[model samples]
Structure formats: structure tokens, C-alpha cells
Target: MTDTQPRTGAPAKPQGFAATERIESPQGGGPGRGPMVGGMVAQKAMTFGPSAKRMVRRMRPEAAPALLVVALSVISVVLMSIGPRLLGHATDLVFRGFLGRRLADIPSDQLPDAAKAQGVVPGVGVDFTAVGHWLALTLAVYVVAAFFGWLAGYVLNGVVQRTVQRMRQEVEEKIHRLPLGYFDRSPRGEVLSRVTNDIDNVSQTLQQTMSQLLTSIMTVFAVLAMMFWISPLLAVIALISVPLSLVVTRTIMKRSQGQFVAQWRRTGQLNAHIEESFSGHALVKVFGRQGEVEDVFAEHNQGLYGVSFKAQFISGLIMPTMMFIGNLNYVVVAVVGGLRVASGQLSVGDVQAFVQYTRQFNQPLTTVASMSNLLQSGVASAERVFELLDAEEEPVTGLDVPQRDGGGEVAFEHVAFSYDPDRPLITDLSLIARPGQTVAIVGPTGAGKTTLVNLVMRFYDLDGGRITLDGVDIATLSREALRSRIGMVLQDTWLFGGTIRDNIAYGRPGATDEEVRAAARATFVDRFVHSLPDGYDTIVDEEGSNLSAGERQLLTIARAFLTDPALLILDEATSSVDTRTELLVQQAMAALRADRTSFVIAHRLSTIRDADLILVMESGAIVEQGTHDELLRADGAYARLYRSQFAAVEAA
Candidate 1:
């Protein structure tokens, strides 16, 4: 790729400059493409059964609201079940009223009772008054049932929302507790998809399934009770379809569950592909990778489409199939009820109630069966979320040291570490920086220079040994307490969307306007700010894309200066700026370094030459350590690097 992204894309592999090497901290990546993109990396995702149960258990904190929703659902279903029976009574009244009119000419008692054994005497005429009363009661029952159903739905919404809100907060907090190695090993897109897309899917799934599932289950049981009460013979016929319904649901659920897993897995991959492509778009174009990127995107898209279609298609068959089975049961129930009514053993009203109960029972079966799709998708997303919450977190520090009030002494004691257990990096390395010393670290790419500074910041814990600040073991200090008195200006300059003045003051929150301007002037940020139309008030976009590299770098310098920290770690902080601006920043940095312990990482030729100590590292160990002149006198690693590097620059 001919074009290089400004430290934001996965840098084109450290092309002979510290600028390109900025993100090569063995962990951090530009944009969202972190070092490793392990799909289900390093761990197996939880299976559906456990994940579904876990999802339900996550709502334990919202138990009160959840219980209320359950109570409402029961009330709603029980009320709704009564409506069918009342309507059946009205139907019987209407039929007897109409039939009685035709039999008016015959004497009353000699004629057979025409109320179909309902206990009403053979009538001389229609009874419109009784039918009206039954119809009114049915309407009132239906109205009340509808109200409770809506209330249940309303309460379920809040319960699901609060549960998801807590979930989002936990995930956010977990991100901070994870070790830098986690990001080093997992792609940024994969993590984001789990955080955002997967969680959102969980919310939607719960919203769609929660109240409806409750109502369906309640309706199934309650309606079955009424059916038995009306007629045991007809109820038994209806019960025959229960086993058939269970078999269909269980088979389809088992098969479609696997499809859902594949569907989400493919979604994560597609998201990763899109992220890497967009972050490195300039490189892709420079290398004519449009077709390659598109082809890969197409591949992932097709994979997702195939799995999603299969999952949805399989789940969709449930509703109609269940309906078909219910219809068959409906036929048997209706025929049997009609026969009982004709034999005069059962009243027409009772048979009418039994037929209505059959329809109500089947409706719930259809509903619960169809909801299987949402349930599968929801559980799949829940498993991914659980995987993150279950990730091993950084060891929690148990003690807190007071913040360093002045220039701090930092020491690294026999530190041993590695990203992978099999491949060791930075083993048994040791060093110390006295208060007010300017210690410079110089090395080639992958020489463990950035790894050294990272140790001081505690980005990764040592596999062995300890780091101490001002005689206090940092491992005993809370991470925040230890980092409180330190300021870092990395080669990768970052600025948020804020005023230029605010960006500079970020180094020290609550600083006065006067103090902010002082730091800005000291770092030459004010020099350029005055030339712009909005000056300090101009709003910079995220990462300061509107400003030049040197401008962004200077603002970061101002931020570090504003803090006036006891210890400073500048990792190639001046590499992005121009020569004149770098010189000014070095002077400002020199003043800033006067009483504070500062660790400066840079190429030997670029750093302040009057450094009190210089360390040359190779293959994760320091091969040489001394002042610049003393190292040159030794004619060792430092001397050779300077001779080779400076000699080439001089010739040019």
C-alpha cells in the first residue's frame, strides 16, 4: 500500500520511522482493528440452554417488577378465559329464542322441552330480554380482559429495559477491568459487536418474547381447565394434540438453535471485515484491493445470509404446522360436541362453550410455537454477552497508596512477562529512574522499548517481579491512585471532539483559563491558535482530523504540560511535529522535566542529547546503558547505532 494512515489505521508495519511505529505497542491498533481477530478466540462460547437460563437470571435485580408482570399476565389470562364461556351462553339463548317462536301453536307441557336439556321449560315465545343480558355480560368480561393484558405488556417493557440497562453498565465496567492483552488478542470489531449489536439484539428479543410468552403459557393452562369443566369427553379429544405440538416444537427448536449460533457467528465476522476495510480504505485503494475487499465482504455476507435464511425458514414452519394440527383437533371436537347436543345428554350451551374453548387453547399453542425463533436468536446473543462478562479480569488491587506529591522515583525490579506463555518477551528486565533524571530509551522496532514504558503505566501486569513508585509497590496501589501523578504523551496523538482550549486543559481538569493559556503558550500551541479564525474556541473533531499532524502533536504536548505530573513518559512524542516545533517542544519538555522523573523514548538522533542516562535495548533486554558520551566512549551498541544512523543523515 502506497498511502499510510495517520496512526489511526493498523499502521503499515513501521516503515523506517517512529511515526508509523506509534501503534506498535504490541497491543493497540489504529481504529478498531486490534492486533488479533480471534473469532470465539481462546474460549468456547456458552451453549444455548445455559445462556437462556443465565439471561433469565440476569433479571433477578428487577425481580419486583418481573413478579408484577407475572401476576398481571395470570389475571389477564384467567379473565380472558371466562369470556368464551359467557359468549357461549348468549349463543344458546339466541338459538332457543328463535326456535321457541315456531313452536308457539302447540300446548306447552305436551310438547317436548325445546331448550336442548338446558333446564329451560318448553317456551311459547322468544325471550329477547334474557339474550340481551347474556350479551352485555360477555362484552364486560372481554373489556376487563383486554385491560389487564395491556397492563401486563406495559410492565414487562420496563422490566426488560432495566435489566438491559444494568447489562450495558456491567459490560462497560468490564471493559475497563480487562487487561491490555485481551485487546491485543481479540479484534476490536468483534468486541464492539458483542457490546453493541449483540446486546441490542438481546433487548429486542426480550421485548418481543417476554409478555407474550407469559400470556401464552398462562392461557394454555387456564383454557385447558375450562374445557374440562364444560365436557371431559371433548377436553380429552383436545388434549390429544398436546403431545404432537410438543414434538414439533422440540425438534424445530433443536435444529434451528444451531442455525442461530452460526448466524451470529457469521455476523461478527462480517462486521470485522467491514471495520478493517473502512479503517484501511486508503491502503486498500492504493494497492488496488477493491476487488479483494469486496470479494471477502461478499463471502462473509453470503455466509450470514445462508445461515440466517435457514434459521428463519425453519422457525417459520412452526406456526402453520401447529395451526394445521390444531385444525384437525378442532374437527374432532366440533363433531363430538354436535353429537352430544343432538342426543339431548348435553345442553347446546355447554357444547357451544366446549367448541369455543378448543379454539382458545389452540391459539396459545400457535403463539408459543411461533415465538421459538425469537427465543433462539435471543439465547444466541445472550451467550456472546455472557462470554464477555465471564472473561478473566485483571487482578483487583487491594490497597491504595496516596498520590505522589512531588518528583517521583520509579524502579522496575526483575520484571518478567510475555503476551503468550510460550513466547516470552521482556524477561528479567530491570531499571530505575531517580527523581529529576531524564532517562532516554532507544531501540529498533520490537526491541521492547514501548513494553518498558507500558510496565510503568501498568498496562500489563508483570509475570514476575514488581514495579515501585516512590518506594511504594505499585501492585499494592489502586490503578487510579498509581496513575494519578503521571502524564503520558504517546506518539499516537489523540484528541476528542472539543474546544482547542478544552483539549489542552484535559491534562488537568478544573484548571483556570489563565493556566490553560500558559500551558498552551509554553508548548507553542498558542502560536498557531492565534492564526485561526475561532482560535482556542474552534471545535476539533474526534482525533483532531481537521488539524495537521504537528498541530495535533503540540496540543498533546500542552496537555502533558498542564498536568505538571511528578513522572512523565513521552513515547516518541515529538515525532509527528516539524523540526522548529519539535525544538520548541523539547525546550518546554526540558522545563517540564526539571524536577520530575521523565522517560523519553525516541531514535537516538531525535531525543535531547544531554540526557542523564541512555539505554540501548535489543531482543527485549538492555544491551547497553550509560550517558551519551560515555556510551560513545565504550564504542558499543549505542555508539554503533549513532554512528550508523547519524552518519547516513549527515551524508543526505
Candidate 2:
């Protein structure tokens, strides 16, 4: 209700769009229908390394919490790594006690030569107390490790989620600051995907991968240290698998990274397609293009499937490949350990611990390799979000200029503009509207009728020249100040989900109930509201689809009425209403326009017949300007347009 005008300042028609004229630019231009997926394409293309680094920086704000997570992960892995060594000791004590109990039954001298050479103690009965102690310690180690692991993941989740929340806020603010021309070229659905689907994907990918990745990496290092502690030679043998795992994982990631980027990019395109197709579903049925739409959907869906399968399949190679290398390394270490044990160079318990360490070392390598998919997918999404965040913002200028009291006198001093620089839409055009005058603009479809009004509203900054209201340049005034004095009703109605009274109240927040009804009565809306079940309380759907076109237009007009602006604009204001209601709206508008400057852009000659002044335009310049009767007497472009329009009606 507070900000009815679009921040982009895209023009609402002279009539139907009451307040939301600024916003409809992107939504108005259906997302691009390129032969390929360009609508949702990233503004800037990026690769895994840079995008990943940027994502890391985004989390820098949560460094303290992130460090806490790392500390926990380190503690967890180190504690867990100690357990296998303890278990190896327990195994040694049990073996020794078993041998001692058996040997004690015989005399020491009568014991086997091997037992004597090994220095086995006699009369030891299993040493249950010692074994029980070792077992309890190992249990404690594992339980603590598990606790730390859980805490690490919990803290990491909050850090990543908070970062994502900030990213969303940045995107929202950026959307408000982006220029209208950006949307004119970009697809609406594509913009929406970046904000909604892309950001969500990024959040999911980061939360799922970050903590697990930390733990896996830490486990590798911790287990390596323990392995080397047991025996340098065996540790070196196990170390061979590290480089081999890296080689395999790196190769697979390089191949899968491109596919992951394509997968998310295709996802954006698919979303854009779905959004556009469904938004205009009625038109599709009316034109009988359902088969065509289905074919396109199938094309997009198939592309996504193929890319997704490749990304997953390629990243999927890491786990099994790493495992194969790990198992091979395990075999080499086992053989070496057995030979050393046979030579009495290593103790039975030490060899046992070394074997367990090998597995612990290889396990984390495998885990990190397996997680490449989520990491790549997340970085791919991060790049898309970054592209949006980096888009050029509208320049903040004209703040040094001053303001003046409103008299509703707008002047164009040699204004020049174009949708594209080479293709001018308006050039060196100048006109003046005195206070209390009704200025009607009539032109062919591409005659710059809407452009003239948009310039006055400062929707687009001028390439040259200046426009002023009450002798104060509009560019100097903030968009907020300029728009506050102007009210508009464009050709297409914009109504959000709200009660009838609320929609009107959007024009003026905190409006009294009586004030709302008074505006409704002026626009002839009150006549129909009471017939509905809730009268003024009746709720309208988001698009106001439940209401007839005329009723929707009337609500918008009533909204403009409540604003009571110093300047008014109506673009085909009565285009939707029946002739009977058109008269009522016209009367209401006249009362509203009294003592205020009003601009009307219309094609209907009868509508502007009584205007104080009329301007005729062709291409990018005005060809004539005068009263309607004066133009009729002159028999120029305006006269011909008028004669043709009425002639067509007579022929019908």
C-alpha cells in the first residue's frame, strides 16, 4: 500500500495501472523466448575456483562460529583416531594373557623353546582387570568423538544459514536499485529464479557439504599423524594413497564441474519456461499452442536430465576410485607389517594398530572424494547468485537539486530519449502543461505516447535535456518526491491479494473507512461492492482474476482518487469499463482533475474531444499540437487518425 509505484519507474498506462506502473516492466515483457536458454542465463559467467573463493568470503562474517566448528571437528577426529590404537593394545594384552595361562600349566624349563625365546610370563590368568580397563577407555574415546562431531555440524549449520539469509537480503535490495532497462532486456522468470530457486539451492548445497567436508579433511590429517606415530615405514606406505586419491578426485571434479554449472543453469531456464508458460496459459489455449509448449518443455527437461546425469555420474567416480586405491595401499602395508612382525622389528600390538590406522587414513580420503558433487553444485549456484549481486545499480544523482511547492506545471525542455541509443524513440521534443489543463496525447502504437509520460515521471534518466514540475527539475527531486505528487492509472490493472477496501487504501495508507468509501463512490465502485457478499470487505485474489476487467479498473481508479495527487495521469482509464460506467469514471476524474494538471493518453477520439489541449505524435517527435476542433479544421495527422478510427467503427 505504501509503495504502489514500481521502484523501476516503468510507465503504467495512462489508465489501467493505478499505482503499480513502475513494477510491471519485467513481468510485462514475458521472459525472453530465445531459441536457447538465455533469459535465465547468469549476468556474468564464472568458474568453480573463483566462485568458491567468493562463497568462502561471504562466510567470513561468521568466522568466529566457523572457527568453533573447525575446532570441534579437529577434536572429534583426533579423539576418534586414538581409539583404534587403544583397541590394538587391548588385543595384545588378551593374547599375552592367553599364552601365559596356557604356559603356566607346565614347568618353565619344560615350556616350548618359542615361548622361552619370546619371554612369556607363566601363571598369568588372562589379566581381566587390565583388559577391562583398556576396553572402557576405548569406549570413552569413541563417545566423546561422536559428541564433538555432532556439535561441529550443528554450529556450522547456523553459520551457513545465517550467511544465506544475508545473501537473500542483498538480492532483494539489489532488485529495488536495478534500472528499468535491465528488466526490459532480461526475463522476468529468470530474475525470479535467481532470487528464489537459485538461492535456495545454494543454501542446501552449502549446509549439507560444509561440515562433512571439514570433518573428512580433518580425519585424514589426524589419522595420518597417528599412522606415522606407530611406524614410519608403514606410514610412508599408507601415505602413497594420498596423492593417488588426490589425482583421481581432481580429475573427476574437473570434468564434473562444467556439468554441475550446466545443471543449475538449465534449472534456471526451465523455471523461466514454466513461469512464462503458466502465466499466459489462457492465451496459449486461446491460440491452441499447448502442443508447442509441451514440445519445448520436453526439450528443456531432456537437456536438464542429460546434464544432471553427467554431473552426478562424473562426481560419482570419486568414491569407488578412491576405495580401489585405498584397498591397494592397504594390501602393500599389510605385507610390510607382517614381515616386520616376523623379524621382531615391530610388536604384535603395534602392527595391529598400524593396520587399523591404514583404514582410518583411507576412509576420510574416500569420504572427501565422494562429497565433490555437492561442493561443485553449491559453487555453481553461488556463481549465479554472485552474478545478480554484481549487477550495475541505478546511479544516485540530483540530490543537490532543490524542491518547490507543487503547482502541477510540468515542462519538457528539448527532451531526448530512446530505448536504444541508435534507435531514438523521442528526440528534442518539448511541451508544457499549465496547471488545471487536461493534455491529451494521441498517437499510433509506436508513436512514443507512453515514452513521453515515462520521461515526465523520470522513469528513465534523460540522455539529454531536462524536465521540470513547477519550474523545479524533476531529476533533482528523488523519485519518491516526484512520484508523491503524481498519480496514475495505466492500461493494465495491478491489484494484489487484499480486501476491496484495502486495495483502495493502498493509494493512501491509514485512510479512514469513510474516506475509502467516499473514493469508491466517486469511481462508481460503491454501486457494485454492496452486491458482493462482503461489500467493501470483499477479498480480491492476487491478480484480481475473480473480478471482471471493468471492476478491477474501477478499483484502481478509486485508488488514484484516494491519493489526491497534485498531478494525475490516466492511460486509457476507461478501456475496460462498460460505456455506462465510463461516464461515471469520467465524472469522477473531472472532479479529481479540477485545479490539478492531468495528462491523458488515449486512442479514442471521443474521450479527448473536450480536452483543453491535444498533442499529436508520430515516430519520435510531435507533429502537431492544438485543441481537438482546431486539429479537425486543420485536417492533419490527428484529423486523419480520428477519421479512420470513426470510419472503422461505422464499417463495423
Candidate 3:
């Protein structure tokens, strides 16, 4: 089949995630609200409220399994904590036995039977055998707990990695579905960092911080319970420090949150600058602006470094402060318990157990303080990602239009458009092309020729008026249904990093190898393909950099031809080709245009001389429209454009 034969079925429209826009409220409101109170609440709430909730909601669906794994790991921590307290109890027993012997000062015959039988003082009750049994049991529990802890960690890591993978995939899919305008508005490096660096931060939190946080919490709870069981008075004294530690942690986090956000923003800026510089390195070299660019980069890099240093400096204070508080609690427990034991209010064993419990209680607090930094960083990264995911999508509301059936008859009626509504790009533009007719759009730069075609394809909605395909409004049709009947080839071709066959098949995924080869031959792409070492299997590097401009354009033409759409658009198709290549491409285009409606945008005036109708546009309006011969006879805008091109050709 020829390139003009329309393929069956429709191409799927890109899918985008749903996002809602809403103004968030401050922390609180009351009947007696004041301006100062409201301002403080708003500031505080903005930092820790809606943004955080949004991030968690975006991440939680995928992170559910990981969260479960974390909970399981927490359970293992609790079991392990039990072992530590048991070890403390065993230690207390040994200390008690030694203390009893020293305090009794009695001969072995005077000790109780049980103590005497074990070769101890007669009236003094100290069981060494019993202590040894308890020690062995504690050791066994420790071994078992350690084994489970390792297992939990191993499983949790796998779960977290998988969760991260899903999140990355979802983000990638969402980006693909989003309108091209979104990318135009956002910096490339900033978007990329959200997917890469930000996701990596979340992954770190999942794999490391999450586990540590769980373990720390479990340890604290278990240790606190054991401390209370041993001695309520000592437990109360140790617990007094908990409130103080919490206050300190809260203060540090509150101060550090804004700094962390600033740090992330600076990092994104630095990444953006680096990416922009590297991507345009050739331009920098050509313009002799390498030194200027380097200076710019250094400024951004320094900004990032400063922000990061400040954030880390603040976050790093938490762990040391926590440790200091923990040590103070330790001192209080020691001094109080020692006084109690001297007064005969507590046994040596009881005092030793309480000390161990105090140490255990502090362990989780220290861990939680250390992990706070990572958790906050992850939260910041997640917020960035959700910001993108929460961006508005293109409108796709109308659904009353009829589907096209491969007969391309496009008409624009008083179409107007503007990338920004305040500045109109096209105004009151009208054009039409009948089925099986070829139309050439000739215009000066910024005359809205490309915008006209973009309207027909519904890339951007018209600000006013309507576009219709086969007598049906394009807006009423599904985007996929409308675009399925059209094929486009542009001067700047983009080929993915894959084999030539793969690239060609991308236009029609299910196209047979025979059909692919036929399309290539029709476009004269086979000649170049055969010359390559691997023919159809040859790999094209990034953006088809391995091929010449003309060659890349031909490959794109081949792809468009392979799709076999009823309507073909050649937007500056011959702009990049040499004279010889242009002639070849023009001939191939003519063949592809047969029995189909085609819109040609040509700088080379000769290629479109045979078009059924020619529209000469200037300032978003068609200044002249007629057959090529009639326009030439009229000596209007089309004639001037033709003459200018002819003069340039002769000069060349």
C-alpha cells in the first residue's frame, strides 16, 4: 500500500493525572480572631499543613506496602527491646549476688541451705546458679531477636525499593500526559530533579530513616514499660526529661523546616543552571561566553552550598542536643537511685535495672532525633513532586463531534488564538482544504501559518471561532480520534535511541516489516538505510545526532508516511534539506499527498507551485488566496514571496 492509504484504528491520546486547585485555609479561626493571630496561624499552617497532607496523599498509595513493612520491622524492634531488658535483669541478678555476699559477712555454714548448698553464706540468700540460668536465657533471646531484626530489615528494604520504582513510573507517565506548555513554563532541570533527586531522597527515607524511626519508637516504649515495672519512682524521674527533650526537638524542627525547603529550592536552581550550561555548551563556545557562563554557574552553586550548609547545620544540632539531654537523664537516674538504695528503699538489683532502663529509654529518643533530618528532607522532596502532579491539565471537555473516517476536509472559520490571552497571536483567520486537495500556506515569519495548522490539529485551543474536520467541530471529537486522521513531518526531526526499524515503527506500532520497508522506499529513505552497516537495524543515537539534518528529516517523513493518515502536514518540511535532498523529499511528498488532503509549509516556493490552492498570510490574516498561477497573475503577497525566493535561489 502507498503512504496515502489511511491506517485503521486511532492512536491513544496521552493521559494525564487529575489535579485540583484550591486555596488552603490557615490553622484556626474563632469568633474573636485577630489579625496578628491569623497571620501567625497562616504562616505556621502553610509550612506544615496542606503541603504536607498533599505530599503524603500522593506518596501513600504506593508507599502502603512499604509502610506495612515498616510496621513489621517495628514489631521486630519491640521483640529485640525485650531481650535488652532481660539482659539488664540478668546483670542485676549478678550484681545482687555479689552485694549479698559482701553485706552478709558470714561463714558458708551460716548461710541458707540453698546458698550453702551452692557454696555460699548460710543465712544469706544469693543463687549463682539461678543467675547463670537467667543469663543464658537472655543471651538466647538476644540471638533470636537479632536474627528477626535482620530479616525484617532485609524484607523492608526490598519493599521500599519497589515502592520507589512504582512512584518513578507514575511520575514519568504523568509527565508524558501533561501538556507541552507545562514543560515550556517549567525549567527542564527542575522537572528532572523532581523525578530523580527528589525521588532518591524519598527512597533514602524509606530504606533508612523509616526503619530507624520505627525501631527507636519501639525501643522507647519497651524500655519505658520495663522501667516502670522495676521502680515507679525512678521511672517518673527518668520520664521527667522526656517532655524537655520533646520541646527541644520541636523547636529545632520548626526552625529547620523553612531552611530545608530553601535548600531544596537552591539545589534545584543549581541543577537547572548546570543543565542549561551543559546542554548549550556548543553555543557558549561559539559565542565566546564560557567565562560568563562559568561565573553564573559559580554564583548559583555557591547559593546552593550556602543554603545546604545552613540547613544541615541546624538539623545536625538535634542529635547532639538529644544526646546531651539523654546523658542528663542518666545522671539523674544514677544519683536518685543510689540514694534510694543507701536508704534501703531499693535493692542493688532494682537500682541496676533502673539504670539500664534509663539508658534504653534514651536510645529511641536519640534515634528519632537523628532520623528527623531525613524524614523532613523526604517530606520536602515529596512536596516538590506533588507540586508537579497537582498542576492543571489541558481541557478536553467537548464530546459531540463525529469521528473522521479518513476523508480529510479541514476548515477554519474566523479562528483566533494566543499563547497568553492578553496577547493574541492569530486573529480572525479562516482557511479550508477539500478532500484529496493539496494546500500550500505561504507566509512571512510570525504570520501564524504554524498556528493555523496547530489549530486544525487541536494542539492549542482557539481563543475564538471554531475548527471543523469533515464538517464536524474538532473540539467535539476526542483528541485521539481527531489526531488519528492526521500525520505530521517537521524540519527538525526527533528520533529516539533505538534501531531504525524501531523508530519507523513508532509511528504505527503494529506495522509489519514489509509495510515499514514499503513506507521507507516511498520516501527514498531506503537508499540511506541500505548504506548503513546494519540497514534497518542500525541504531540512531540521541535525537538522531548520528544522521545529517536532511537524513533525519527523511526518516521523519518515512515515519509519517508509514502512519498512512488521511491528512498530512509538512511544517517547514524542506527548510533543512539541501537543494538535491529537497527535490527528492518534494517528490516523495507529492506521492504521499496523492488521494489525500495535505497542508504544505514551504520556504522553497517551487515545491508548492502545483498546490490546488495557495494562501499567502501576513499578520495572522490571509492577504491573498488563489491557485498558484492566479496568485502569480495577481502580483500580490504570494507573488512577492515567490519572487523573493527566486532571487535568493539565483543568487545562491
Candidate 4:
């Protein structure tokens, strides 16, 4: 391949995790209530079946409580459903007394017992006692229904809380099992969004939507059944509206679904852009690209507005359209019931009950309409979460790896490796480092310097050949076992939020305070720590931003010294320090390297002149290997690199 051409490697590909929308949360916003803009504003249309099924399977443990909630909800709704029918009887009793009509073609036995009782005025009668009795029964049913409703909510909340906690735990555990390559390829913000935003979406849905959905569904079926029982004619009239409402809902959703998808996808893209722009703000300003950056942001903002407006507009139609259709059904039911009542084909009480049932029927339809967007957004978030959970994890092969001898001898025997198997980066590479020797590797950028370090750490499995440490195959060793015996200090230092003392003792978590201080002193880190106001107790913020780059490097070196591992890997460890600090660091490093095997990957050829072995690499292969002076005498790749660096320094 030409230098400018790209090379394809592995034919095998890892599963692609879905990109999630960047939801902008309002201050103190809790889950579903959060004010989302951009991607969150638009709902993406996608099938939620797989994700929903997976969630249901995972929620099996909480099935009993869910079922209990369902049962309670059903009982509460059934009691409430009886209220309209009983109230109608009370209305009919009063109407009968006023109209002076008792015996009709309808059977007297079908009438309530209260209606059959004699009135005080004989023909011109009022059944006061019967009305009171009917009123009392209706009130009792409602009171009991209210109690059951509250209990159902209480049980639902507990179950949802426990289930959400379990989901969060699983996601955290999954994070630990994912390979380092996954992190390397994926954006940290995107991954974070899944863990926090997407999971939170699921939690909110379970807590709020689950109950509402169950109630709406049950209410619809109960209302329909009651309507049919009252009069099949009015029930048919209500059923006509169902098809019309569904048609409207489906049409609008078909349009809004795509927009929702666009909104969320664009939202993720917009967030990624903002993150990149902010991170590289200095670079943008230095290159006078502020206007360009603004233009880019404006373009993204405009795109979001267009898609979100469309999505909101389309979804907004659902409630109003359903409402209009439901009212039309209501009008027809009322007119037809009135005619039937006048003709004595239906009783006044039956007409009243049917009207109430019609109104109740529309209620669930309205609820379902209003909840359409929330359900869509929730399902979208769920799918994204499930995608993450279903990602491929690092396999654990519990093979018995023989323990390495104490010598720490390392060897690479004809190793053939490639980042992409289609194009080999390193072919038939061979190297050996006897115990207690300092081996320096110098190479240009893209020469696979870091790749070598990655291999030694077993960050990626080798495609072919074997790497042995003291004659024990590294592949046979567990990653934890192999890595525990090695200590590494890289150019890009990392420090967590903790005290300076804690950072120094990171590699050896069990080290006492004195042991930590001793390690720091050995690395000359104590010199700086003592100068600080808090000394060893000084707090280091995340990434050690409070400390200078060189100081961060110093702390990492101290951490490595604390472990005193058999094998040490230093990658440009002193590149950040000044000349004076560099000299001191070098002195400390020399003492630390005593009787320990070390591999120093350096750009500064001068620092490794005294190394027992120097491997000069170019294009992923070592072109020269020898003592520094011996390589200089040979006048090859190493000599040219050294001469060029020295020339540049002298010229400057």
C-alpha cells in the first residue's frame, strides 16, 4: 500500500454499539421530567420489540410484585367501574317517582329491589329510602377503590426502585468485563450517556409509564365490556372511533417516528461536536478558526431545530385528533340514547349509565394518545441500553499458566502480529532481554513503539507466536496475574482524585504511610511533596490537574517504585520534566532499575546511551540493536536519528 492509502486488517469485526442521543438535562431535573433538547426533542422511529422483550426477561425476578400491582389495579378499576352503573339506578329511581311510572313492559324483577318498593304518595310517589341506599353503596365502592389505588402505587414504586438498582449494577459489572480495545474505539461521552442517560430513561419509564400503561389498558378493556353490556348499539358506535383514532395515530407516528430518530441521532452528533470543540478550544483559537467553529455549531443547531419542530408538531396532533374523534362518538351516543329512552326501549337509568361509560371509554384513549411520545422516547432509550448490555465481552479462558521464574527474562519468538490481520504491522519479530538488563527501544512515530508496550502488557492477544516471561507463556497467565508482576510508568500519567500519599501508594494499596513516603523519597517525589503546604496530604484532583505534568509523572514513578515489580516498563517517563528535574529523575530511575529488568522506550536517544541494549526501530521492525556507542559506530538508522535530533537542538 502507498503511504497515503489505508490498509484493511482483520476480516472479523466486533459488534457495533448503537449511538445514543445527547439529552440536555435541566437543573435538578429528575429523569422523565428533564427538559431535553436537540436529539431528545426528536423521537427516532425504531422497533422496540427486541429491547422490550429483553427487559421483560431481565425483570422476571420482580414479576411477583408486578403481578400484585396489576391485580390491585384491576380491583380498584373494577370497583370504580361499578360506580356509574349504581349511580344510574339512583337517577332512574328519582325519575320514576317524578314521572309516576313504575310498571312498564320491562320485567319488574329486572329492576332493583329499591325500585319495586311502594312510595309514600301511592301513584304520585318518591322512593327516598331506596335512593339513599343506592347513594350509600356507590360511595362505599369508590372509597374502597381509592384505597386499592394507593396501595398499588406503593407496591409499584418499590418494585421499580429495586429493578432499576439491579440494572445499574449490571451495567457497571459489564463495564469491567469489556476489553480495553472497546474504550479505545468508543467515545467516553457516548459510553457515559448510555450508563447515565439511557439507563435513567428506562428507570423513569418503569416507575411512571408502567403503571399508567397498565391502568390505561385495563380501563379500555373494562370500559368496552361495560359499554357492550349496557347496549351493543352504543358499544358499536364507540368501536367505530377506535379504528379512526388508530388510523390518525399510526399516520402521525409514522411521520414522527423518523423525526424522533433523527432528533436523537443528531443530538448525539451535536454533543460530540460540542465536546470536541470545547476540548480543542485552544487549538481552534490558535488557528483562528473561531468563526468556523461557530458556523459549524450554528449548522448543527439549525438542523436540530428543524427536526425537533417537525417531530413535536406531528406528535402534538395525536391528542387533539383523538379528542375530536372521541367527542364525536360521545355526541352520537348521547343523541341515540336519548331517542331510545323517549321510546321506552331503554330506561332513563340505562341511558345515563351508557353516557358515563362512553365518557370513561374516551379517557383511556386520551391517555394513550398523550403517552405516545413518552413511550416512543422510552423505547428508543431502552434499545440503546440493551445494545450496550449485549456487546461482546472479553473471554476468560481458565487455562493453567505456569508461574514465571524469579529471573524476569523476556523473549519474543518469531511473533507475527497485526492490528488488522489483513495487513501485518509486525512480522516475524524476535527479541530477548536477559534478566536485570535495561533495554531501550527508540523509534519514530507510527513505528509501533506503543504497540510493543501493549503486547508486553497483554492488552491485545497476539495473532501468532508466543511471548514468554522466564520461559512461561504469557498467554497461559491470567491478565491480572501477568500485569501484577509488571510495573509501568507512561508519558501520559493518570492520577485519581485523592491525596498525594494515596497516589504514590496506588500500585501497592496495602503499603503503610511510611512505606509510601519511603517510595516517594526514593523517586525524589518527596522533595516536591514536602514543599507543598499539606505535604503528603495534599489533595490531587482528577487526572492530577492540580499538579504540573512533571509532578504527575513523578507521582506515577513513585507509585511504580512502591510495587518494586520484577519487570518495569517506562515509556517517555521523563519527557515532561525540566533539565534539572530530568537529571534528578534519571538518578532515581537508575537506583530503581538496579537488579530489576527494565524496558525504556525513549525518543531522547541521549538518555539511553548507557543502556545495556538499544533496539532502534523503523516501520514496526527493529533495524538495529546494540549498545548506544556501538550503534553510533555502525552509522545506520539509530545514528541518523541521533544526529538529526542533535542538529535540531544545536540549531535552536
What's each prediction's TM-score? 0.92, 0.91, 0.86, 0.87
Better of 2 and 4 by TM-score: 2
For candidate 1, the lDDT comes to 0.80
Clashing pairs in 4: 9-420, 9-422, 10-421, 39-263, 42-260, 43-260, 43-261, 44-260, 44-261, 45-257
Q: Which candidate number has the best lDDT?
A: 2
Return model 2's CA RMSD, one decimal.
5.3
* Model 3 regions more than 4 Å off: 1-46, 49-75, 100-128, 398-404, 643-652
Ranking of predictions according to lDDT = 2, 1, 4, 3
Candidate 1 per-residue C-alpha lDDT over 1-652 given as tens digits, one digit per residue, 9 for 90 to 100: 0111112212212211122243243344332233222333554656677888889999998889888988888888888899878877787777666666665565666556434365443454456687789888888878888898898899899989999999999999999888765665566677888899999999999999988888888988999999988888888999999999999999998889989888987888888778778877878888888998889889989999999999999999999999999999999988888888877767787777877788889988899899899999988888888888988998887367575465689888888865446456656767888999999988776666777777787776779888888878888888887777789898888899999999998988899999999999999999999998999999999858789999999999999899888899888899899888888889989999998899988874557578998888766678888898999999988888888898988999
* Superposed Cα RMSD, model 3: 9.6
CA lDDT, every prediction? 0.80, 0.81, 0.72, 0.76
What lDDT tens digits, residue by residue, belong to model 2 across residues 431-516?
88999999999977656677777777777788878998989888888877788888999888889998999999999889999999
Candidate number with the higher TM-score (1 or 3): 1
Model 4's C-alpha root-mean-square deviation from the true structure amounts to: 7.5
Better of 1 and 4 by lDDT: 1
Q: Can you give the lDDT of residue 516 in candidate 2?
A: 98
List residue ranges in candidate 2 displaced over 4 A. 1-44, 105-120, 400-403
Query: How would you order the candidates by TM-score, starting with the best?
Result: 1, 2, 4, 3
List ranges where model 4 is wrong by over 4 Å: 1-46, 100-133, 285-288, 398-405
Q: Which ten residues in a row have the lowest lDDT in candidate 1?
A: 1-10
- Name the TM-score of candidate 3: 0.86
